[model samples]
Every structure is written in structure tokens, then in C-alpha cells.
Target: MKPDFNAMTRKELRAYILEHRDDTEAISVIVEKIKADPNIHWYKPEDTDRFPEIFAEHQKCREDARRNQENQ
Candidate 1:
């Protein structure tokens, strides 16, 4: 039986995708989730005024990741 991708957490889905690279459905779900995440920001070249905001967001994401890893 196929696993229910919707029921899986992002971390679980990531692990599943790595182990089953051929599962395009799982990949699609993860891609959609990422696209819908509010914390994610896509920077554009024309948004010059927003560079600082974008950079700060990126830095915050990196720091949060580091903290999560350290806690783990």
C-alpha cells in the first residue's frame, strides 16, 4: 500500500523522499508545502530595497537551523 504523504510530517516526508527518490507524489507534496510556507521568502532581482529584509530572513533561517541541530 502507498503511504499517505499528507499524514506525514515534513521531516518524515524528507526522509521518505531520500529513501524513495522515485516517489514523485511525495516530492510534489513537499514542494507544495514549501511553496505555501509563510516563513519562506523568494527574492527578486528588482526588489533592491528589500535586500536587507531578505538577507536577514536568510540569516534567521540559518541560525534557527543551527539551534535545531544543536538541540538535536
Candidate 2:
């Protein structure tokens, strides 16, 4: 008998995938559940005011690294 994927938690589903790599149906169910979950956000949007300052700092660091590389 096939296990009910819908009843499994994300961790259980992941373990099931590792154990049953050939089960495409189980894989599909996991993908669909994750997509349907509203709380499964990968990245939260940062505050815009802080974001620009952080991005500018990152850009400056990258530019400095590139200049140092070119000088070497």
C-alpha cells in the first residue's frame, strides 16, 4: 500500500524522497505541498531604506576587490 504523502511533514517527505528516489509521484506531491504553503518564504523583502545602503556597501566592496585584483 502506498503511504499518504499529504499526511507527512516536510521532513518526512524529504526522507521518503531520499529512500524512494524513483517515486516521481511522491516527489510531485512534495513540490505541490511546498508551493501551496503560504509560510514557506525563502527570502523576506528587506526595508527599502536599509536595502540601498547595504547594496551600496556590497558594490563598493566588490569594486575594491576588483581593483586590488587588477593591481596584483
* Residue lDDT tens for model 2, 1-72: 979998998899999999999999899999999988774433446555577776787688779879999999
Candidate number with greatest TM-score: 1
Clash count per candidate: 0, 0
Question: Any residue pairs clashing in model 2, and if so which?
Answer: none
> How many clashes show up in model 2?
0
Query: What does candidate 2 score on TM?
Result: 0.53
Each model's lDDT: 0.90, 0.84
User: Residue 11 of model 2: what lDDT?
Assistant: 90
- Per-residue error at 44 for model 1, in Å? 2.8
